[model samples]
Target: MMFFCCSFMGAVAQADCLNTENLLKLDAQYETALQVGSVQFLDKLLAPEFYWVHNLASLQETKAQLLMRIKKPEAQAHQRRSHDVSAHRLGNTVVLQGLSSVDKLNPDGKTLRTSRYQFMRTYVEQQGECKLLAVQTMKVWSSEGN
Candidate 1:
């Protein structure tokens, strides 16, 4: 009985890691979408009730609003890269926490702004697909001393 229980627990642990890994890959695709302002990619990845809290404005945007912004002609391209990403699986939900650096480019393709941020995103599985539910980001003011 003891051996059976140990094996079952080990299997559960391995399953959790596998789930986390899958979510991490999805999160990477999300980062790419953000950088390129891919509305189509975002539409597929975001839940209908998705919400995002921006780091600079402290503003919250719904899925529709976010898609609208992405379609704007003046919208800048964002080059974002995530680092030290960690995903935690909670049943059908996964939470991703990471640090990211972003470079914002103007419509003319000139670099306009750059910043580092810490972000947390939650993804929920629905209909055999994972979608982003909510995300919140905070700017990292100074990495110099760290």
Candidate 2:
């Protein structure tokens, strides 16, 4: 009986792997929407109280403010890519860390503002469903990019 219990526990431990592929897909959708200057996906993904901080050290932006910005004509040609994603799950909390590159095109694409950023996201299981709770980002210039 003890051996059977140990085997069951081992199986449970192995099954705890967090499937981050879906999260990566969501990240892709977000980037695609940003490149297309469309806020549709962002609107769906961001929580009502979502907050975002830009790499330029600007103030945090709420979901409504972000939506407004993305809807403007000047929002075109913004591209982003996420890499080196690391995800961890502990009990009912999940954390995601990744590196990102962001580029916003200028009038001639010659003045593109590019930067490398690292982000940490936390999700909590609320009422048996996981939902994003907070996110933070930091900018860095690295020769060996992500």
Number of clashing residue pairs in every model? 0, 0
State the lDDT of candidate 2 residue by residue for 78-142, as single tens digits: 56788898888787767788888877665685667777788887655544333445677888763
Model 1 agreement with the true structure over 5-45: per-residue lDDT tens digits:
23433443334433776566556666767666677777867
| Candidate 2 segments exceeding 4 Å error | 1-18, 107-111, 124-132, 142-146
C-alpha displacement of 42 in model 2, angstroms? 1.7
Error of 1 at 88 (Å): 1.5
Against the true structure, what is every candidate's RMSD? 10.3, 11.0
Give the Cα error of residue 17 in candidate 2, in Å.
13
TM-score each candidate: 0.75, 0.67
In model 1, the Cα lDDT at residue 23 comes to 65
